[model samples]
Target: MKKLIHTLLAGSLLTTCLATTSAVNAMTVSPQNWWAGMQNSSLQIMLHETEIAKQQWYLESYPGVELKSITKTDNANYAFINLEISPNAKPGKLLFKNRAGDQFEYPLLTRDKQSAERQGFDSGDTIYLINPDRFANGDSSNDTVQGMAEAASPSERGGRHGGDIQGIINALPYLDELGVTQLWLTPPLENNMASYSYHGYAITDFYNIDPRMGSNELYHELSAKAKQHGIGLVMDLVLNHFGSEHEWMKDKPTTDWINFNGDFADGKHATSHARQTIQDPHASEFDKRQFSDGWFVSTMPDLNQRQPLLATYLIQNAIWWIEYADLSGIRVDTYSYSDKAFLADWTKAIMVEYPNFNIVGEEWTSNPAIASYWQAGKINNDGYTSSLPSVMDFSLQESLIQALNEDESWNTGWVKVYESLANDFLYPNPDNLLVFADNHDMSRVYTELKQDLAKTKMAMTMLLTTRGIAQMYYGTEVLLDNTGSNDHGDIRIDFPGGFAGQKTNAFTGQGLNSDQVDMQQTITTLLNFRKNSPAIAKGKLTHFSPKQGVYSYARISEQQTVLVFLNKNTTAKTWSLDYMREVLGNHKSATALFNKQKVKLTKPLTLPAMSALVLVIE
Candidate 1:
């Protein structure tokens, strides 16, 4: 009887072992081949398990690889292992050994050296900014989350329209023909909010990309594909705050992890505080603290960048993405809201790690002095050194608005842009300024200008031909507009025909109004022209306000010289040659870029009203 009972138990144990082996074999790993987006000699490997605690798993690289550290995360199901690859470690499969002697193999690909350096894109490139959820709905299956609140349909202005990273990737050829060289999608990081999370500003997880948009792996793939088409990717980073539902809020890491935790503080207004503190002779420490540390919104918890650990975490998160995505640059959102010291340190560290990388900060100050102060080489009266290389030219935006809305008189209106350009001396490197007519935060450029096509064209003409770097918000080329509503939802409208069921498609130039098509063609022509024109890329800028409502500038290099003239008058105005004779000395003949007409200038040239002219002088 004892022998028979022992045989039965042994048979049951063998059956259980075989079942486990079969289950392991049935499991599948996606994205069979893995390529590190950005990497160096040192690598951090994160492993996740559905059943067993990751701490029970032992991770070891190839025979010649060196282990730096093996760390268990707060969640026992994940493990973080740091390893140093051998200088000649042949790229192969990474083996993870579990306590049960079960092994999982993941293939690894070595870094592409040429591609890594290509990550840093140039200013000559046009950036298309899309609010993903409002751009297109390539995949509708992932529209609603299981337990999350359901968003309204695409027709609803504020609804989550199911636009994903795949949609943008699908429409790459459209962007490419539009002469876009870089794509800046608003923060794709996870935002687990119940409503209005479509904007992606309130991030819940820094490490994971929003599943609604796509997986983190898909994002890396998008970057790789973008690079293949001569396009770069610029990540939008938010360091000031995190979503209130962020995991850290549930269980505080430290008492000082966030400012005014649980309890909300009425955030101080930005303009006065940011501008006054920098300009004030006796700015209070308390006031400055409130300006930078206050929460942006009740739903967004402000991060205490002053905290050492929190600061380090934020910095490392940014570096991890830069190295992980092989990104071209970063456009920091709400840049002024973060601690000034921390911002300086963060930028400095990033610049040190990637010497040639560039970062543009969103310091939305309309004053040139205030904007210039944040740039790296600004000579401030107060000894403030910023590691920031570029700042959004809010002054230029103000100038554009004034030029469009105001009268054409010399002392009053449309010449504000010319006058603003004269103030470029205030900035140490004016060429580095990111000049834009509009962005995601504000009303669409078309809406702001009251849907005036001529003014829109003028804005694009200046943006493309100007001295500084230029950025065009998505949909601007197609003249996308949100007529009455000034809210963000309306501003970030759905791109026409982006969805599968849509009757009109912007990609094929179908279902577009005549004005929209004209704007698209104009922008495309100018951008492609600028791409091959060395005269516009690296040229010396010279300007003269020959008269009211008439402004002209020349960008000259050793190989080529190009001149631009803006005439805002109702009638054709003749610009006297005497006023610009010194600058145009020995240049008698010029060819217009748009019309391809050549003219000999002896006395004065007639510039039409509400028109811009670009001349190539040989």
Candidate 2:
């Protein structure tokens, strides 16, 4: 075996020299290993070492595998090895040698049985979004590690709180009991930033998990154990930009690797956050470039995906994580900030590899037209084709908050939500969209609704029974709120009982107040029932317009029917059922999901003020 040494040099690609004759000691390769028999026969391995481009290497007699070519960039330190692995190839080690007799072996592993056929989270599953660093502190030892810039500061809201992967693994039973079917943790990849690294969005290393969180093996363990509890794992992916502290920033693979030639120009190249430019036919080229190529912040340098090599690296990095972590789905961050052409190709490659899988992108726009433009089957006016199966429904989320906060009127209150849902015609597959009231980036649902438990419950009820897949931010059931502050750290506050010195322990139910307990029970009941309800999961959604301070909708299927009434009234009122005859369809009496009392559909239903009423017909 030859020794290939890797270093943090600009475009340095490792090439081994014979151990017997050369003194080279080690090397680094992106996607260090691969699986045989993948749908995509081609693979590109990025080798980074000193003067690696000058080495002439050849494959050592591998069956069903061929070294198609070795391409080098302007930087001699970087080399890209492209290989074609046929379907007949089996899992084993493939050897390579240069003319100087230096040799190295790459392992091609076997895929897991039924790996490609894995089912992604959909309307049937309730996804729980967790900020891993704030969720729990199962492992305090790793909170402060050697060589890491930041140390744990549990008292400071924005500081690291020592939560690790083991904490999530420990909370599996708790999550299972809450009836959550899927977990979408914020990215646990190595941020390696000096500050505000707890949110895990600024990725410094794509291939490895952060040691502060856990190892790559431990993350795989979380996936496996989560499966045991009947939950799927959805990884959070970032492709638009990376932490400025990343090694790539110091030693770029190519001159054009970073957007604007690795210069932020004192925020001159910052994004306008004008996502609408992507779908706007009249959008100027300058506006489009500013939105796409601009850096998010000085600390997050935008990636130049137009560079073909960097594009391939990102696409392969996503696939590698999916295979390595046994992921069931992915939630892309800042989806529209990257180059549009690259976004199409990247999504296409992932879907082609796993046709049954799903990927949801975060467009973060309240405009349904712009959001729907990215779904897989939409026929855009500009002839843009997208392979994205799911997108976050920011329109509904924004309207729901407004509806609950405002007074009832023709153009206000519940009408806002009704009009929002009326725009569903804009989406190709509305049911495949991700519906959530709040996530990590914004304020918590409870806080946004002014810590009103009734309003919060109404929001959760609406989401869980809606047409699209539902997602809940962690601590929502217990009414965690970030009142008077919109800080990311405050929004992602520590989960009670997850850490020490807290009066409340949501896990053990030890110090919870009545409101917390009631909220928790409400979510549990709705989630468990939703888990089995064909009506809520795959039914047709038919909602009536706002009438007399009430917004009502019905999810009807052959097996069951669910009726939801959200009343924002200050006083209990009798809601007439005459207008919903089309959906009610001969149903007489129904059972209330919360209290299990039989409701007579034949008479006017009495709706509790400022609360969500859910009834089921069987």
Candidate 3:
């Protein structure tokens, strides 16, 4: 009898252990739980669980959590659960359960609680744009995937370099010290393309973060850390197209889901003829249709934003990221490629949702008139309206390139840039323009200037002290080079010290040339100076002509005033203050922001050749 009791006791213990193990195993996380990264009210959670087929899956939360509905798939293994969370729902863990008593937990991050009315960004901040894969490889283990055809190699221009979000997060201190207030990363979404995915313009899954860069959760962590350092996050959004290998492309929901369903063609040239039509006085319908409905590349299938369902999905996806990652702004890629009406609607809805947030569109035109038409507040005679708050200052880019490359001719001297600014009257809000010399699509500014250290410094001085918002491409300050080619791959070189085995470290300022060091120091000095100056942010700008290849401007406000002089001549020139008197406002003593030297501006200010200066009046 005692032996029998011992057997029964041992059996009971074994049973309990098996039950606990099974319960723990049942609580598994979905590998493709993309919705888990979201942080908004309307959330659609897609689940794949074969074991829970017979059981009902429901979301449970504390009071104020509103469950929309539970939808089960025909396969009985998938669930599409929708939930509308209350604004007051506590930011914490959300538990999901099944009828069999299995449970899993996911986090609900803090939503942006600020109202939509607060919409204005100060000009003192500098935006740093980075191409993730080439920036730094914080995690190299995920560089090459099993199915991906491209191999990981730094020497190969088109191969993946494995830069991840963690690399940038780790370099926050370096960026902060460099006077960067905003970080704009290229789209980190999944790109399952076969080759040349380093640029990240073609997205395969809008909701899933690329595993090569780390999981979606890592991106959220990066945003949180960035906010702690007072750095705003600017997500690069691509609403125009998706990779050809996208899962949805295999079985499109509708025939009109893509621009040329099943039939592919190259995109039309982005010329005035293509864009100005649709309402042109004499435009062929064929031209207009081709302009609006053409593929960007054979690999990038153009999305049909004109379709209401697709439009809503794209808009909602953008909002989800903003609320999820607490993004400060969005840099919409290929903004002109999408449907015009749909683009207008997308911008309007986003503004309605977060009026305070900023959206900068890339129009990519060298004409100020063409670029200004896309910015908000432009009164077009054609009765068209755009909700975009800001646009890339491509006109300024052209002027800067010209000013650096051309000689001091009477018609095209350093005054090219000065003249470009003079045309700011065409823009509804010139200060809202995103000014940059080079970006991901363009050659490196240093390479374009032929590695002229002085010219690069002058460009930086003007970009930081100018009247518009400044965006500096990553590695610009360090004189990062892409010398021989203008291809996208060449432009995005890997950041130093981002990977584990790198010998040189950019973060700690090691292995840098003297010119690079000087450039880095110059940018840091100028940006830090602008950071505390309210005059540069909201002051009125006034400019004067090129005398002896010199151009000058002054920003004045009630509390503070600043003057900037650009001298491009071979010899030093004395810039007359007579024309800038209107904005200088009777200031006699001027202080140099970079060198901290005091000067009496009662006489003409002497500016060195190929140099720029920022003078603050006390």
Candidate 4:
């Protein structure tokens, strides 16, 4: 009877607790667990409960971790506890006690061996960009999770089509066979919004992966399998705003947790343009405030980094993910919209922890001058210094595509590529930049070239052999295009083999047309050759001015040199080997890279019309 009464009271008290406080806030903490043996000894853990700060909760003594202080915010529901962990802290759980004598356990895990010294993605790696939700469906049972709002609607283009982490794991062999060394997946964090959660930009949970996709353990499994295939994982992170349904939004850590709160009568303020004023020297304070303080959308609340605690929380969240997932690289979305000072500190902290790591920021602008300003070593007159080592080369993507589609002329044709490279002096480390022909946000390169195969090949050749890191979208191998519409849903369509019952399976080459097969072959050959070609990987690039209907360039290293020529005319032309004598030298013999034929370079080489020829000068 005594045990029965205790159990009945416990159940009754739990029911009352749920009625009073929402399920998420009753008893939990952000970053549910942390790893031991981190180089950084200081760790801040945030706790959430119903007026927990006012209630009595004392920390129990634990080994290897010292309770520094319990910091409370203006809101009584939240508390920030700072802990100083010793370098030798063992992987164990720390206990805390409530007034009712209830104990809460927070687990501390051990870091992987030599985790701090892991190498990141570099120029030598060709990145395969995948939208996980649209990639493949490996498991049918996980199509619609129980608690999730959105159901899998395969008929709708934008609906969730049952692609999960298992789908990506299933396609690893195909990716590896294609010579892809890195996988860059868009944000996989939970977005519990009722509608349009397929894109995953709006995050509702930081600590857990979406159940519809998979569990946290499954993500770790995917990472481990990817490493076995000699592939690195790059995570796309968005730090600007989060979904309104985030746990903290119900009762913010403080009144100022979100920006633009209580600023308008209708609470429907406009999203900030956040445009050129960020780079302007004479911009007004209003512009800066509006840019940094405004929300992304009504449903996505912008976080205020001006609050010191919020700033630290965001930084710690990033570090946690890196350690948790063993990530190789991070691609920050809306990189320039966040607080400039916070971004500098965030990058510095992560780099200090892992010196070999690489982070590329997404600044979708076509101006090289603007893009280079955020690079690490650029000397800006404004006296601003950035720790970001790499940025996406949107200018090169625009120039290369525009150059390929236009006619050869004095100011047109291949001059774009030459001039684009001429501006390389603007960036501190241009080699670390990510160069691509087209990504999810833009039209496919094939579409941009008006479905011309020769033009497509020329652009692909430049992208693969260019100076910076190269990235290929998921369906680019099979000529994924949105000729009639530019909607993101259309652009990020389901991969041919990703879904079941599809007529064409790009992976197995089933139901594929000749053009798709040939394109895939072309990319596979180029990528495999590049994997072993040191000259193309880290070589010094030298190119002559686009002249006489030929745009030619050479990648030279100590061991070998590769000469690439693109003909811009409708008729076949003979390219003169005489002008390239300095780089080519008196090398009388050469081998064609495409066909692997030993050709004598003693005289002018015959070139096909509107074709690309790569020759290894011997």
lDDT of each: 0.74, 0.90, 0.75, 0.82
Clashes of each: 0, 14, 1, 0
RMSD (CA, Å), each prediction: 7.1, 2.8, 7.5, 3.9
Using alpha carbons, what is the TM-score of model 2?
Answer: 0.96
Residues forming the 10-long window of minimal summed lDDT in candidate 4: 1-10
Give the alpha carbon lDDT tens digit for every residue of 49-143 in model 2. 77878889789988999999998998887889999999999999888777866667788989998878878888899999999999998888999
- Rank order by lDDT, top first? 2, 4, 3, 1
Show the colliding residue pairs in model 1: none
- For each candidate, give its TM-score against the true structure: 0.83, 0.96, 0.84, 0.93
Runs of candidate 2 with Cα error greater than 4 angstroms are 1-25
Q: What is the per-residue lDDT of model 4 for residues 1-618, given as tens digits with 9 covering 90 to 100? A: 001011112101111122223233345566666788877888887877788777565668877788888889899988888888898889987776656655566678878887898788888889999888899988889888888878888778778888889999999999889888889988888888887788888899877778778877778788899999988888888877888888768889988888886343244554566556677889998888777777767777888777788888887888887887889999998888778888888888888888899999998888888889899998987887899888999999999888988887888879988899899999999889999999878888988998888888888888898788899988888888888888888888899999988999999999989988988988998788778888888888889899877888899888888899888778899777888888887678889988999877788888899888888864
Q: What's the C-alpha lDDT at position 11 in model 4?
A: 9
User: How many clashing residue pairs are found in candidate 4?
Assistant: 0
For candidate 2, the lDDT comes to: 0.90
The TM-score leader among the candidates is 2
Worst 10 residues of 2 by lDDT: 6-15
